[model samples]
Target: KKDIEYLSLKNLTVELSNLVFLLEQQKLKGLILDYVDLKDNGDYSMEYNMRLNLEYIHFANVEMNFFRWRDFFKFADFGKIILEFDRLLLQENVLSYIGLLNSYKNVLYLEIKFCNLYILRDFHKILNKFKYLQTLKLNRYNDDRNSSLYMFEAIKNMNYLENLTINLPYRGVYNNSDYFFGMQNFKVLCLTGTNLTQEIPNIKIWGNYTLLRTYIINKAIIKVYDLIEILKIESLTKLSFLDCDIEPCFNYISVELSGIKIKSLDFTATNLDVLKNFDIFKEFARLETLHLSNCNLKSGWLTQTNQSCNLSLKILHYAANCFDRNDLNRMNNLEVLEELNLRDCKFYSCGFFELGNDCKFLGSLKYLDLLHVEINIEDLIFLKSFKNLKNLNLTLSDADFFTAKNLLFYLPINALSLKECNKKSIFENSYSRYLYEENINLNLNSLSSKSFILIRI
Candidate 1:
């Protein structure tokens, strides 16, 4: 009680009276009141003997409606407060919530999670009161289209807000000129979810509207105008179409933005026509990491991409698709690849065999996962060349196409991942059980020599 500076109550189901009694112990520097019972009394404004001296305070799953901030915080002073409450945490009385916000105008950092816009009657009012709020995190949950828009619309007067994280749901791709207002000075922005361009995309606006990086238009038909709009974002860098399906009506979706510095593009689980004709990487000169996993790149799409544009790529994760050795060989064009994940992929013809030239470009590769992949005996030998390899995950083929003893005999493999998928046969478990049956129990550490690459039958 004498030197207690930090106090955190998680999943608390006690009354405010009990919390008040705990507050009798002064000098609390930081307090996290998580899952506390703020609904114990109809009113929580009373005189207290002790003064709450706190710098950081976090309230989770608590309603501030009945809790009068003025009475409780007469002598209580805090700089940072995190309110992680949802619609359920609020009561019918919204004025008390506004009162609580008005009382804490001195806080520098404020984070409100799971904010339902429908219940945020005074959200704009509360925001206006916090003139000193430098950092704000508004994590909205399942609010309606209008409500979500209102929440964004309400974000004004935050002159000090430098960092903002808004992860509300929506359906579109937005440009800098489309929505974000009064937040032009923000340095750090994390839009963890979908942000539609205005409620409607057909609204004709005056020219010279500033276009941000890029926008992801969802559940909408792509037209010529849409394609043109995508190209307008001059500062486009990273693009992710998790499950968006874009029509391949156009024979070619040529992008000629030479200044488009896209470093990472994720088209995983996204269905599109031919990745070849699109030639979307023409202007993606600075593309570093690309994820086209499960993109249905059928057979020969990889070879068609502009090789010069992908030279800067360090991590190429394209797996769980049907492609052959001839197609995989095109990856050799990406001369500076550092990491490659070819797991759970189906090859029309063996994708990993005779890497005589297919494996030449992976000079900088540090991490490789060849789990449950199709390959032959020669492909296993192909791994020795990757000198920069650090982490390796090897899962032998379900079918014994490559019969080689001592499956993992590479030297200097820092970390190894071995997973057994075929439960019926343990003998084929990374060629481990076969050694067990042959009375040849080999310790991995005992037989790791680089100079001699041994393969026994």
Candidate 2:
């Protein structure tokens, strides 16, 4: 089967000419048809050396009449198409059946969820026929405010539109921060709104947006003077404040809005407990990724100020925040952190060698999630002092089975998930006699030796 290249077909009743002859005899390049029931076997002839290089096609809750697969997307030859569609039953009127996706006009990447573009008419003439669209996600676009500024003025002249996701938050849809001042050749602009707290239209028209890098603002309200003109745009470098609510007006400003070349700053579930002393991360000194997941952070919510004491943070998520030890020693100034998630946290009364002795970025961590942490085995033997821990998730941990076989016999872990662990002590028999010793190699789910240790239960 040429090692099947991604094909997910949920539910049944296929026959779209036997699902395009099973994606051309299993040469599939990704195809997920959930809740399928396609059936349109009239065999709309196309056999002259028939070719169909599909690059990804997802059709959720799919039934049929997707324009009767428009003659199998007009004699298939799709390449970079990443077309997704949820709640599919398009029958019609979705912008007059969105020109039946112009019969696959290269659709670079397009996601349309829960379809219902409210009162959106002439949606940019059906998105300018996806002129090789470069990523576009639209979900529940409850159009209003001039049909959402004519759908952001027809996707700002598309020109290979570089990522534009509009998930209409709260859905009252009145957005208008000048409907994204002409997108300036957007390089990722996610806007979900409620009020997006208008007003911004100055700051030299957002420094002409200079090919805006990445700017997301979901569940909006933002108004610290429109987040200082969106930190003066200056070619933004990734800035998200999902589930937002800023508005403190930077405490009646008095200077201090430093340089800011934003190097990723997603305040997920953003509330920041009311801008705890604000210090907008001392105005981003090229901050290296900081997501503050589910922010309900305690213990001085980071404020050792000396301008955030030289943060060289290289990824720190802080999932479901519930810290302690002075909030893990104030994230020991993100000592060159190299990825740390802390998923669904709850370590309040300190554990895991007190978070490996008060988080000094857990000794240059190399990816660690700790999903649903309620850890055990002496707090999973303090993750052997994270000597550059190479990927460890522990999905739903409680480590047993001899503490996950003593953490794969002393961690040098190169991927360990343990998803809902203890599946019959993970095939015990003394763990298949330590995987038949020798050079090691046990399957069912990873456990090769001399390195690659992905033991995901």
Candidate 3:
């Protein structure tokens, strides 16, 4: 079933004439209906050969009516509509789904979760009738006290929105961003405000969007000169300071994070734990993929490397911090670090990751996640000389079932993990004597002796 093109009908009571006989026998192109309780005035306008080759339609907690969803979107002949109208119950079926989206004028990606478009009375002129709406998400988790505050000014005629998400809490969004000025093709924006402030500073009136690129800070708490003036927008690359909150002065925004040209930086549970001078990762000369989960750096973050280190880092996640050994040698000078997650850190032993040698420090490490690190057994014995090591995770306290049975014999590990070990029959009798040693054909204890296996040859 993974040859999926997309078909979902959740919480079903499916019946609109067998749901238009399963969208004309599934000649589908993405259709999702959650909490479906179909049958409201069940009228399929003579199925039109079960009209539907839909180009994406997601309706959550659905309710059918507006001419039974305009006869299943006029039996969608597969073109127009990237609609994701979610979890609704708003009556007059959202003004008959905005008069069935004015006959689907090529609807381009519109998301309205937890719906209540202020009862659609010219709701932003009915979302500018999708004049090629690039992508727009609104009212997600719309704090319903019987939903009301809505004031969004119809995004001043979409004018080709590249991507805009407006989470309407206590709602008051009114965009005209100078009608998407300089037509820079806005890249991505998530505007959040309940009672506003922490500084949106009206996103500097969005004029010189200058090709804005990814800025999600949903659930506002923004500031620090309105997020360093929206990361100095010179075609910003990516900044997801998710679930918001910023004002933790990293050297007072280190001279506005030095001429920003952000290249993927997500900091969940933000504030960067009182940021101890990562000198703002030497001002992003193209920082590549850094998702800092649970930031807990006590001064000495990313420990060293400056003189504009041009860090094109390849994925590093310091999950559940307390990561020791100068935080894994401040990622051994990030030499193109290819994926690493020091899970549940703060190693007390196992030679503070001198791991008995061979990890010339993240030498282009091919994914390593040390879940719950309290290492031993010689830090999984020389960490099998990491160089492009495929995937590895350790748990059952990093060895001692006969030193994890020579851990797949001097590790030629394509992917290996030893989960939940507290001598559970010594890892199920050493994974049944390492799968009866079929001449030790290195299937490395075949994954699950209770989870953590990441098969990646």
For model 1 the local lDDT of residue 440 reads 34
Each candidate: RMSD: 8.7, 15.6, 16.2
Stretch of 10 with least lDDT, candidate 2: 447-456
What order do candidates take by TM-score, descending? 1, 2, 3
Candidate achieving higher lDDT, 1 or 3: 3
Q: Give me the candidate number with maximum TM-score.
A: 1
| Candidate 2 structure quality by residue, lDDT tens digits, 135-154 | 88876546666666666666
TM-score computed on alpha carbons, candidate 1: 0.64
CA deviation > 4 Å runs, candidate 3: 1-9, 14-37, 40-67, 71-129, 132-182, 185-257, 261-281, 285-289, 292-340, 343-369, 372-374, 377-394, 398-457
Tell me the tens digit of each residue's lDDT in model 1 across 1-457.
4888778887657666566667665667788877666544644344453256678888777544344444445556778877766555453243344456444566788787754544455455566666677677766544555555555654555666666666533544233235554245454444453332323243232132333343333323334435445555455565665655454454454544456656777777767563345565555667788888887777776765556645687888888877776676777667788888877777775546555645656567788867656545676677777777776655544343235445445533332333333323333344443333333333444332221111222
> How much does candidate 3 score in TM-score?
0.34
> Where does model 1 exceed 4 Å of error?
1-87, 90-99, 103-125, 128-137, 159-183, 186-224, 247-256, 274-278, 357-361, 398-405, 409-457
By how many angstroms RMSD does model 1 differ from the true structure? 8.7
Whose lDDT is higher: candidate 1's or candidate 2's?
Answer: 2
Question: What is the Å distance of residue 354 in model 3 from its true position?
Answer: 9.6
Error of 3 at 272 (Å): 23
Cα-lDDT of candidate 2:
0.63
